[model samples]
Target: MLLPIIKCGYELCKSENSENLIARAYPQLGKIFQRFAILQFFNDYGEFVLHDVDPNLLTFFRSCLSR
Candidate 1:
């Protein structure tokens, strides 16, 4: 799911019409990439077993990306 989304984003970013499309799509694209990064961070660090990450931090990240 994430792979496809990232691929689409990359394709769009490479397109000739990217300037106009990306300008309008930046917010949505940012949210997708941010979520992917967060998920990847936990997956890479083996933090899920400890479950130590705070939910509030995720919420804060989402809020910041929304802007």
Candidate 2:
């Protein structure tokens, strides 16, 4: 799940930039993008188990990615 998103981000960054800003920001963007992807995945597939999901975990994920 994450591998593909990271790869996509890498490819997008590589294609869009001449500088290494993408590489430098990969960690942050990767975290953000993966979080978004996972949330969407759960929204689409894990709808049945959504009630058991931890809101704090999502917040923590957001915090980690923000840094």
Which numbered prediction scores highest in lDDT against the true structure? 1
**Model 2 lDDT on a 0 to 1 scale:** 0.68
Which stretches in model 1 have alpha-carbon errors above 4 Å? 1-20, 52-67
Residue range 1-67, candidate 2, lDDT tens digits = 6679668867777888746776577578766766676677676777666465578456747686555
TM-scores for every predicted model: 0.43, 0.44
Cα displacement (angstroms), candidate 2, residue 18, comes to: 8.2
How displaced is residue 4 in candidate 2, in Å?
Answer: 19
lDDT of 1: 0.69
Q: State the lDDT of candidate 1 residue by residue for 1-67, as single tens digits.
A: 6678668876877775668777777787777677667766876885546775568457746675566
